[model samples]
Target: MSTEYKGPLSVETRKIAKDELREDDNSRAQALRQMRDWIEKNPKIISCRTDDSFLLRFLRFKKFSVPMAQEAMERYILLRQTVKIAFHNLDHTLPKMAHLIDNGYLFAVPGRDKLGRRWIIGRPGVFDPYKFINEDMCRVHGIVYETLMEDEENQVRGFVHYADGAGVSLPYLTLFTPKEAVRIVKNGERTLPMRHKEVHVINVPSSLKYVLDWGMTLISDKIKKRVKIYTTAEEAANNLDVSMLPKEYGGTIPMSEMIESFKKELVASRQQLMDNDNMEVRLELFSVQAKEGAVSALKSGNQSCNPYKTDVLTGSFRKLEVD
Candidate 1:
């Protein structure tokens, strides 16, 4: 029989594997090293598979030398349970969701604050903050929502299937706004909205423009002519949406132009890598990209790249709407 498992969380949202894994620094390289050392020293929490890598997936991250995994696991459980605490302020914050430009999702912005802040405090920064169409949901006792149902409350809840072929579902908690609906009408996929006054310009990655070019055709406005591409950050600012352009096209720092800059820097970094010859620098660059992405994901009211979910549940939960 399937039992209701009010057990513990399996992973820690905050406990990342390593800030940067280095070849030389064995401690940061693998969880195996930490587990083995701790088992050798004797750990009260562990009894079996004391030095196995498979078990690493079951626990949380810890200090490199010893298995602080138990400590880390406790923290993960605490965070998962307390996620609702941060949401408690949603009612007070997002009083209206119908007109919001960015859709009120939390986003991490780099260097915006003096002390530093992430989306949910102790987490990261989130732009376009909001609560819902008519209510707040900072506490667990708040009203739950139904997707595909445009209630007067406007609280839209749904699941999004994963892109990049990852088999995962992301649940959305929010109030639907008109701006988002418009973008959906325009682009087959959702986009982050870059608003300047009354005009809404969406910033899209160049790789994604082909899809958007056609997507915007059905948008409310009939004048679907060009997906105006900007060449520089300054120019992109004028359009309110920034995207990389081919160097030949002359807009948002071109990949070819970026490659030229890379050529200059690579010559220098190449020598440094050879001198120090650390393989981790290459990996570190990849890590930086992932770390930076966390910030963009949390922004509120973003048109594209915002939380435009596409997850489908086993069966959609719907409430009847009044015309």
Candidate 2:
């Protein structure tokens, strides 16, 4: 089959898609058409981009299963409507958001890794938990994730996270309640279309080891197995290429330059981020009977529990599995 529709895919990535995702020109075109038709028929989805690029993210993530992709699209829309803190007001020009970007709290590195996965480095330790709440951090993460999703390469190859935990103190750890942590994990695994490959945590203090152990309980088993903890940056460098990393970790490029470039990218994509707010779930569009059915479906499908309700503090942390 002619694979011209697979635009700009490297030979390795093209092979990965063909072998692993069961993708080809014929299947890709068919899946895109099916998804667009499904979106047009669904009343709850008020607006969405039905373009090939936008629809393909869900298609590839679900391995070309139209039904699964449809369900994932619904969950993605519902997440935006319900999670106002993270989804709403995604303007990069906002003072708080700009401040976060300027400080380089979280951003994707410019290039892909050896396996073609994108690298996202987060320096949460640099931010003040007292000044910015956990929700603020979530908003920043949401923006970065949304921005990264625009790239076809990232969607195809997946992502790796390097979490610099050098400066995280007890206060920073306290910012995340058990329920909040659970919600974050659920959203990443269920709502988002991105594939998470690995998470490398470096520079963790001995005092904070227990906190890391507790966090391990909340993630899904697949992600739990992917998590690798390293005592120093040198150890992590052995796994991740230093050339793609900033000079702070012995890379060639200076960290300041990388931060500046990332900030510029966010500013350039500000309008696109703002446009996401237009696509939402409009329950009012449905009839009374339809509305009730829709509400029931949303409640049943939602993986996140009530934010206000705290998880019971049994001696052990709650284990939330990924689907």
Candidate 3:
């Protein structure tokens, strides 16, 4: 069976992974050494697979500050523990994950934004909240974890969650449980290793406004600031590069092809995802005080978390309607 759709669609998105680093940019090489040294010297505080690429992921997220990167890595693992989702036995081959893959509500777009952040689309088509299982959501989270592991070059600057609520029925909004909603918000907003550049909720039906507000209340003010509601696809595309987005968001590539390619990529990277299982924090090594320190490290706002201070786009979430 063919893995990718090979029509006249622009292959630009498919080729985004081949970004070249500048010759003068020795910062990463330097960061790699410092991070390794830090890990070796402080084995008690940090214990994970010492993969160079794995270490670099945290270093890049922390902007190469050795101490800060160490803290971020520890905090990430601890946060995974705190969330208590499918961190330990996250197998993509599970029945629930397979169901989610078949449904394809969420998947990362092949292309990156202008700033190099991955553009992930969440098109929860025909949402039946009664049918929206939490494990299905966890499957999405596992895919994201898989994505971060495979991003060795640190080319993924951040992420944009474009939630296409176009086809969601009103009942989904009302029926979604607060517990499930809180779990989704806490993990997706606070704990994920990458920066959340933006969240665009498009094509929101008028009847579900109250449900939307209740869901929004669960979203932290920091993340809620990034949430945007749009009446039309055109309005939503303004915040994203249309060419990078699939046809669902007024882009050129067929959504079916984009999703197929994503599935192929996921299958191709299965081994790397398994490798990541070793890299998760072994919480038993750290003392209670150490764990508290790691959690506090996450709250320090050292890396991409403080995008506004780091000179990223500065703006609060907005509600828009295009006539």
Candidate 4:
């Protein structure tokens, strides 16, 4: 909202980040491909880009429709508030306004000495962000990100953390991918045990129908099998089957049953994907929200709402300028 954040995703910052990343020889082609596709598909984004003051207008739009956008952005600033703390994606330093995604690196510091729990820290090349990427170490990585809000007393340190399972990192190319493609090619799929059964459907069957269909809509038939893309529940109720539904099918063909079966398939597929996925690969920028919306809603009213409560959320420290 302030002028300082006029456009967190501006060209200058992106240019700078890209150049730095190149120094490490990382391939940004994947991200560029996805960004193009996303912009091309979302007319709103295209129109926003045409304006010289796109950043300001975009923030306002988000404030109106989603107050959280501002919060997320602010949190990002705090996340990198100081050089004392920083985020890392692999060995490459995180870039400004970088969308969090699966495979996106996270850096933090867990308190040391007595406060240190049973887990390990500072193992060289062991996804151990605490040892490096800290306020004191960020400079060594060629990153001068914000300084610790106040590191005069180095008591503030990192905690366990990682990108949201939904985090995404835009390869330098700024490519955009449809949600479905993201779950597939970029994130990959997981197959079920072929035995897990008994699913229950409670939401709008029509909506579920739509999401599952994305697999077939964007995917050509040739490689669909490898991706496990399909219509309706095969052995289950077959919601994808309009041909077999009776004249009274819409009102009669046990639509509820189909939803249940389809749910089973989806749950298992994602579980398979989850098993193979690196916690980072499962998250993307806005992916925390992007990934948790549905699951949260389901558990919101239930007793299992705290998704990351027990999961190891690694924490890291950065230098800041807090008053």
- Give the alpha carbon lDDT tens digit for every residue of 1-323 in model 1: 12222222223212222331111224423555554454445433222333232224223212232334544332222222233332123231233321221221211111111211111101101222232322222221121111101111111111111011111111221232323323224322211111111212323345444434544543434233323444333454454322322222233443434434423432333332222211111223234433232223224654354223322211221221212
Worst-scoring 10-residue span by lDDT in model 2:
314-323
**lDDT of model number 3:** 0.59
By how many angstroms RMSD does model 2 differ from the true structure? Answer: 6.3
Q: Which scores greater on TM-score, model 2 or model 4?
A: 2
Q: Rank the models by lDDT, top first.
A: 2, 3, 1, 4
Which scores better on TM-score, 2 or 3? 2
RMSD of each: 22.2, 6.3, 10.1, 24.1
Q: Cα deviation of 11 in candidate 1 (Å)?
A: 25
The alpha-carbon lDDT assigned to residue 264 of candidate 3 equals 74
> TM-scores of all models?
0.21, 0.84, 0.68, 0.18
Candidate 1 wrongly placed segments (more than 4 Å): 1-19, 22-69, 82-104, 107-323
Mark the regions of model 2 whose C-alpha exceeds 4 Å error after superposition.
1-8, 283-323
- Kindly indicate the candidate among 1 and 3 with the higher TM-score: 3
User: Poorest 10 consecutive residues of model 3 by lDDT?
Assistant: 310-319
What lDDT tens digits, residue by residue, belong to model 3 across residues 1-323? 22122222123422432232211135555666666666677655444656555665565455566777778777667655544444645555666665665566767778665666777777776434566655556556676555644564323356777877776664453333333344455555544556666888887777666557656765567878988898888887786678878876789997778777777777787767666555545678767754543322134444333223312111111121212
Candidate 4 wrongly placed segments (more than 4 Å): 1-67, 82-303, 306-323
lDDT of each: 0.27, 0.76, 0.59, 0.25
Pick the TM-score winner: 2
Supply candidate 1's per-residue lDDT for 260: 42
Better of 1 and 2 by lDDT: 2
Worst 10 residues of 1 by lDDT: 146-155
Deviation in angstroms for 216 in model 1?
41
Clashes per model (N, Cα, C within 3 A): 42, 0, 0, 78
Predicted candidate 4 versus true structure: per-residue lDDT over 1-323, tens digit per residue? 22222223335434433443221112223322333344445422212122212222222213222233334323332222121122332222233212111112222222222322111111112222322223323322222111111111111111221111111112211121232133232211111001111111212134234433443443334334422222323322343222322222232434334334323433333332222112122123334444432222133354242232221211101121212
